[model samples]
Target: MDLWLTLAVMAGAVFLFVTEKLRVDVVALLVAVSLLVLGVVTLPEALSGFSNQATVMVAAMFVLSGALQRNGALIAVGDLLARIRWKWLFLLVMMSLVAGVAAFVNNTATVAVFLPLVLAATTANRWAPSKFLIPLSYISQAAGVCTLIGTSTNLLVDSMAREADAVGFTLFEFAPLGIVFVGICMVYLMTVGRLLLPDRGVPGSATADHIGRYVAELLVAEGAAVIGRQRSEVLPDGSNDVTVLEILRNGAAVRGDDVRVEAGDRLLLRGLWQDIDATRKSMKLKFDHVARDLDGDLNAERLHVEAMVAPGSHLIGHTLAGMRFGHTYRARVHGLHRRQLGIRQPLDQVPLHVGDVLLLDAPVKAIADLRIDRGLIVMGSRAQRKVDTTKATLSAIVMAAAIAAAALGWMSIVASALLGCVALVVLRLLDPDEAYEAIDWRVILLLAGIIPLGIALQKTGGAVLAADQLINLVGHYGPTATLAAIYLMTSTLTEFMSNNASAVLLVPIAIATADSLGVDPKPFLIAVAFAASTSFATPISYQTNTMVYTAGNYRFSDFVKIGMPLNIIFLITATLLIPRFFPF
Candidate 1:
């Protein structure tokens, strides 16, 4: 009965994870509570994950990653990479740099830091972002498996191994095989993978070309030059940059090109930022909403930026006007891009959703503040600011010290990371509040809540039962075949769920299978770690992929075309190499 109950809980959790009806972290917490309620795990066991070494280390790594981004260390590197002239050379170097950083920082954060830089580079080189972005995300996943601290999945597998009395991996134990995989991926992406990528993005100016046009409501101010002219005469077809989408008279839509413009009349106009600014200046127009709500002039030297609404943001489901977004963020939403919606309504009235790309116009100083807001991800900006050398140097030194300590056995991975976090705060590189916000609480909570399910599987003997079934299917073929099966199962499951969750669920079964076959569990554990970390077949399979999905303007089929082959390559490489490395 206990075994059946545990299995039933696991099945339900898997269903929730794949469907994404709830947030992954929320689903994980529900799984923990369900296990406790079903009496599959005791209260202590259910809560053990919260204090697990892996969970704490993952959180600490976030702070370390955040400090690097906050202090301009990563941005400085981006500035140098932006100067590469040739497209192929740029693509190769960019992936290599991103992979190196991803080995130490969180993969999502590494991608986030470089995203704007890559977009800007592509725009400058007249290259499509779709050609480069998928490779960026794929390479990060490959490099993440090169070191134990490279990804949370590696740390989770290491922590679980220790709990099950298996030897934990060294910091660089996976480096040899992981580096081989990274080389293979880098080569494939530059050669055959390049052919499969879609050329979807329009290559032109970063601001005027493909960023999309802005739709804003502007009022014809008193004494405006065009107040007495007909709308057709002032904004005739192909006459100027601004297109009058609709003419509003006292809150009613007035149709026809013959309608005469009047003072105080609101005209919904669409155009590029430069053209819009030129038309507004020439016509003496004012933003209808900005004039009514904001005290300052909208004509200040402004920065145009493209930002996406991030997942788990408080701003989700709230209209820009309802939230007073202009007042709250000190920025004006000029236009928005939603992949699914046509966006026929007023921009301010539309409720924001995840992955909505917002084109913003704000004062130059506001760009920094906007970047810090967790609610939005700034994809690109027109401004090029100077980096603080002092902070960048300190952050680099601190991150290096942490990694060296762990690798040299001077401290455990968790302790070294904690010490590094303290040093960053003490050095004034990151504020206390900034440090707190840096940690992705969703990932931390997901790890904490879902880890107990692994314990429950062990206690209920469900892991052994499942392993028995797997062995019955493939054990007769030899241990190598069983290893291949474990790797394939893990990689398949990771494509549909959280990689860390997949690792937690499968590691126990992998261990049990190894024990049953009287082979070394190290090979199986290594397979699980590699398979779980390198999720590439779907955009939703990994966070970095999702970050680039909408930004690159890619379709669902783009990933399948490029990533499926890469996934198979990694699987084959791991199967042939894991046994040789650890000798099953």
Candidate 2:
């Protein structure tokens, strides 16, 4: 009954994760709670994940990465990349730089910091951003597997291995095979992968210009020239770029070319920003201000900027009007850009999702506020912040020291990371609030919530039961083939779900399979770790991929065409090399 319960809960969790009906963290929490209630795990075991070393270290690393980002340590490198003129050289240097940075910092942050810089460089060189953005995301994942601290999945697998009484990996243990993977990825991307990438966006156009068309609601104010004009007369087809999709009278949709525009009527229009603006001026229409009175001091100098809703942001499901976005951020959302989706609803009523780029109009001072908000990644040229060179140097040194301490076995990774975070706060490099905000609570919660499911599987013998089925299917091919199977399964699952969740769910099974086969579990554990950390088949497979999806103006099939081949290559490489490094 306990084994059945554990399997049932795991199945349900995977379904929820893939469907995305609920957030990944929420699904994980449900899995943990379900396991506890089903008697598959004790209360201590159920809650143990929250206090796990991997969870703690992941949170601490976020703070350290934040310190580096805030102090200009990361941006300084981006500034140097902006000078490269040759396209090929820029691609080479950009990939190399991003990979190296990602090996130490969080992969998502690495991509986020360099995204604007890459866009700016590609625009200046007239290169298609789609050609380089996917590589940037893919290489970051490849590099992340090079170090244990490089990705949260690595730490989670290591901690799980230690708990199972197997020898865990060192900080650099993954580097040998990981570096080989990175080299293969770089070569493949430069040669074949380049051909697969779509040449999206117009040459020499600004990133904002490539955001595609948007849907906006415009009000026909009193005394507007179009007040008495027929709908066809105002937005005549083929006369201009703008098209009126629908007309709303007193909040109800009204259809027909015979309908005359009224002073209070709202027009749902679709067009480019320039065309939209031009239409508004010519038709004497105004933006339907959801929060009209919130726009304080309209005379102040305002700046137009693009900002992306970051992954794990608190604003994902809320509407602009519901959140009173203009009042909260003191910025009016002019338009929204979503990849390959035409938003037909009112702008303020549309719920924000990850990677949705918002066109914001705000006062000059509010730009800083937008930059500081963790929920938004302000696109394009970053506003210059006062950088303290001394603090920047110290922050780098502190981060290096923490990594060295963990690598040298001076302290456990969790302790070293905690100490480093304290040093940053003590040195005034990061405030306590900033440190707290730096940790992506969504990811932390996901990790803390899902880990116990692994415990439940192991305790209930569910892992062994699953391992028996895998063994019956592939164990006859010997340990090498079984190892290959494990890698393939993990890689495939990761492409569709949370990589960490995939790892947590599979690592225990790998251990059980190895134990049943009478071989070392280290190689199997390593397979799970590497496979889980390097998802490349879909933009939604990893956070870094999603970050670049809209910014690069890519279609869903764009990732499929370019990333599927890379995923297979990585699978083949890991299967061939992991054994040589760890010897099954």
Candidates in order have lDDT scores of 0.84, 0.85
Candidate 2 lDDT by residue in tens digits, 270-317: 777778878888777887766667667878898778888986577888
TM values, all candidates: 0.83, 0.89
Superposed model 2: Cα runs more than 4 Å off: 202-208, 213-215, 220-285, 293-304, 312-318, 339-346, 349-351, 363-374
lDDT of 1 by residue, 58-81 (tens): 999999998888777877677777
Clashing pairs in 1: none
Highest lDDT against the true fold, candidate: 2
Q: Which ten residues in a row have the lowest lDDT in candidate 2?
A: 202-211
**How does candidate 2 fare on TM-score?**
0.89
TM-score for candidate 1: 0.83
Query: Which window of ten consecutive residues has the lowest lDDT sum in model 1?
Result: 203-212
